[model samples]
Structures are given as structure tokens and as C-alpha cells.
Target: MSLRFSDTVHGVDLPNNAMLPPFDDAWVTSWGAERRDGIYVSRPMTLQVFHTRLLEHAKCNNVTERFGVTRDTGAPAVSDGILWGVASWGIRKLCGTERFPAMFSYLASKSNLDFLTNGTQILMSDKRHYPYPDNLFNNRAETTPPSTTS
Candidate 1:
């Protein structure tokens, strides 16, 4: 089965001459459920492709977007919790087409985040801080529109 996901990309810095690592050791996590009508929905599991090597490969493949933040605006009082870049994902399925998108949508609905907006993005060299590799840090490039604050 071939599952491919593609979307317009923005805000990414591509790396030169890079190759991704294996997925066997990748990490996966869920954001939990959303309360609706006194019920909870299952949150979709987002696969984290941490391996720095893999991230490098993703950048080469054009699955991630690079963006520059407008620093002119005074820094936040908290000094944190601001988004700098995003990672977009494309899921290509080799079998069962109808069920895939629907199932994924259902799972994402439980997380309370808009699946379409909170997609994935490639990671820059500076974003690697976690001792353990995480999927959130790994991202591929896409041909989406670039994000610029002007």
C-alpha cells in the first residue's frame, strides 16, 4: 500500500545533500480527545519522525516549508509559546481510499486542533533540543506558498 500526503508548504529552510533515517525507531503520540455533548472523541495519532538524519532527508525531498518571523513586533511578555515554522504532511494510500481520509479526519477531530491548519513542517538545525528524537521535529518540504509577515 502506498500512502502519500501532499500540501502547499511555507516557512522552511532546506538542507543540502541529506538523507533520512529509518522509521522503525520513530515515535508516535496522540493529543487526546475533545469533549462534545458529554462525550470524548478519539484523537488521531500523529507519527513523529525525529531522527535528525531523517529530518535532513525530508528537507531535501521538498516536503517542508521555511519561513522567517517578523521580529519587529515587540517580543511576547512570556518570551515563549510562539510558532516559528510549520510541518505539513501528505498521506498517500495504496488501498482503501474512501476510508483513509474519513478515518484520519475523525481521529484529528478529537484533538481539538484543526487538522488542516496544524499540519506538519520540516525542522531546522536549531530546533533539535529534545534528548529523545520526536516526530514533531522531523518534517518534509512541500510546494506550498511561503509565509512572510510584512
Candidate 2:
């Protein structure tokens, strides 16, 4: 019952460290973001993470990639969204897994996302955000070729 989600990240500022905040309807409303066809594109987010809501909770050890997000506003008229980090969740120890891959990431269907979050969130963080605490900001030093992954 181990469920994992990983992807070859794109357009992310390398060495990115982010916190996908838990779904908060009020907060989203505050920023005037709305759901369309059951999806949300929160304007309160900056680079896949909340810009100022970073100190309200402790960081969770892991989280699932539950939905796709698109940024429809920016200088170029549309800013490509940020990275999609991985999670090794299994109904429990969701404190997950991530791999720096060189190619071909998995594309799971909506049913797959349902299997993970039980239909409560479209794109939510797992309740937390701790201090950046270090200069490296999680600089990864390892990367694996995509072909050999399990």
C-alpha cells in the first residue's frame, strides 16, 4: 500500500524549497481566487509556495502531489508553474520519498489522486511551514537516471 508520486520538475528555480500550504477556503477567498470545474489556481501562492503564510504551522514530513496548477498571470502573460516534488505516502508514514530524476516522470490519472487523498483536496499542502533554517535551502546533491527507477 505504498503510494508515491514523482516527476521531472520543470521551470523551478533550482534548489527550490517550498511549502504547499493546507487548503484554506477563506484564505483563497481573501485573494479572490475561485474554483472552476473543481480546480483552483491560488493567487496567494508565489513560486508554488505561500509567500507570507510560511510561519503559521510546522512543516509536515511528507505530502502527495494531488493536482495540476497553472499560473495565468505574470509578466509574460502566463508564468509556467513551479516544480512537482515527490511523496512516498502509504496511508501512514506519508513522510515520503523523492528522487532527482534525469527523464520520464509518471503521469497518474485523477483516479490515482483520489486513491491518495480520499477526495477532499484538489491541491493542498499538508498543514505546515517551518523556517528556512539553512543557507542551502535543500540543495540536492544526488540525481538518478530515469531508466533504473523502480
Candidate 3:
């Protein structure tokens, strides 16, 4: 059976690039983010749901078959679309659960915050491009926990 929006493996389905809007399909779902203020301190409900769901799927559901499709060179393997790998770093840091390895790098030269909060369109017209729909608001450097030794 094909996956639907309600299909849940611990309450989430795997994702892919085709999951992008204008390209979404049966096994994948998509969402768009809207502008908001206090973006650093106040979580946008849209983005909160996004990163949260990604975390849930990683819990005890590593590389599940429920997410597999019979399209990978005439053999079936659990899907590993670009979306999964890209978001992995932040989510893993937040919850200590490793999913995909992040491929996105911070643009020290540019800021996504400005465009996300003021763009006329909710998503970039080229929705499939990286950092377009993703609209990364912030990135944290890998930091060590504080040491107790004086």
C-alpha cells in the first residue's frame, strides 16, 4: 500500500525532494512557512511542527522499510532523499538522535532571516532548490557542555 498523509511510523513518514510542493507525491508530504517576528526567540508553529516530526521519525525508526519504494534501480531500499540528509544536523543536536548527516552550510555572507520574514512569496518559486523552501533561520555551532572542573 502507498503511504498517505496520515500514515505514521511513530507519527511521521520519510521524505524526498519530490515531496516538495509542485512536486509532492503519494509517499511524501509538504508544507510552507510564513513570516513572523521574534523569529529567534519565538518558534513559528509551522517550523516547530516540521523539526519535531523529523525527530519523531528518527526515534527507533532508523531507515524503516515503511518508507521504502520500489524505484531505486529495480530494487527497493529505504528512501534517502536530499531533504532527510539536509535537516539531520540540527535535529540530531537538539535531541541526541542521529538521522541523516547535514549537507547544508551556514552562509556567513548572507542571512535567510531577512527574506523569510519579508518575502512576498511563502516559498521560493524554484521550490526544489536547497535553502529555498528550507529557509534556514539559524544555525548553532557544535558546542561542548560546560566543564565543572575549576
Candidate 4:
């Protein structure tokens, strides 16, 4: 399913193109308890789309220049940490989604640069970084939305 960003996140409205990537059940489940806790409840496709758009925006706007990234540096080589921070700020100030604060909190807690950098590929490949006992959405009738309260 396609995922669209809310008009605003944390008082910031995202650009019209900030749509998330496609959904994947394996990736969503890989988030483990965070998915169940609602802290990482965004559907896998939705989150991926959001992240892809975030990175594309950063590249188009030269937002990575502030982080010492030069034009010579391949876009893919840029650190996800920088991108995440930039995207997070954008989501907080531009999109203003109510869940931005919660997402920010979750990011702070994880605080792993690699996680953000490799997250897209990892999720897309349906690989799990950490073992989860079960897929929370597997048995649920509604795998999206209503299942997540956050």
C-alpha cells in the first residue's frame, strides 16, 4: 500500500512530494517491539517512502552541503545520520505531523547512524537486524492504521 504523509508533523508541513516508499511486511516486523509499541508503527512502505522522499529532497536542495558533503560525494555515500537529522527537522518544522515528536524520540533512543544509513536496503531486502519472536501484524486483521494508536 502507498503511504502519504500527513499535512503536518509537529507543526511543520512536508512538501507535496514527501510520499513514502512501498510497504513490506518483513521490514515492519523487523522493527520488533518498536512496531508493537507504536513508537515505530508507521507501515514499512510508508516509512520507506517518507525516507526516500526525505533523501531526495535533501539532495535536490543541497541540504547536505552544511554537513561537509561536497558535490563530488555520491548521494548514496552520504551518511544517513545527517539525512535523518535533516529529514527529522523538516518533518518537525515543515510537515508538522503530530507523530514527529514521537518519531524523534525513538530516533534519539536508537541513536545509531548505521541503522539510518542502511535502513532502506535492509527493509527492502526483508532482512532482520535483530531477531523478533513473531510478526505483530501477521495475525492482526488490520495490519495498518487502527492497529497503531500512535
TM-score per candidate? 0.19, 0.18, 0.17, 0.15
Runs off by more than 4 Å, candidate 3: 1-52, 56-61, 65-113, 121-138, 141-150
lDDT (10s digit) by residue, model 3, range 1-66: 965554342222223222322222112222222323412233235412222122221243452212
Q: How many Å off is the CA of 17 in candidate 1? A: 5.5
* Better structure of 2 and 4 per TM-score: 2
Q: lDDT (CA) for every model shown?
A: 0.24, 0.25, 0.26, 0.23
Give per-residue CA lDDT, model 4, range 1-150, as digits (tens). Answer: 965667553221111111121221111101111133223334344322122222232233333222211111112211221222232222323222322221121121122323543663322112112222122212212211112245
- Which 10-residue span in candidate 1 carries the lowest summed lDDT? 101-110
Measured with C-alpha atoms, the lDDT of residue 121 in candidate 2 is 41
Candidate 3 vs candidate 4, lDDT winner: 3
lDDT of 2 by residue, 10-101 (tens): 23211122332122211101222344554554555533422211111222223232222223122111112322222222221111122211
What is the lDDT, from 0 to 100, of the residue 52 in candidate 2?
16
Report the lDDT of model 3 for residue 126.
21
Kindly report which residue stretches of model 1 are placed more than 4 angstroms away from their true locations once superposed: 1-17, 34-150
TM-score rank, highest first? 1, 2, 3, 4
Residue 49, candidate 2: Cα error in Å is 17
Model 2 root mean square deviation, Cα atoms: 17.4
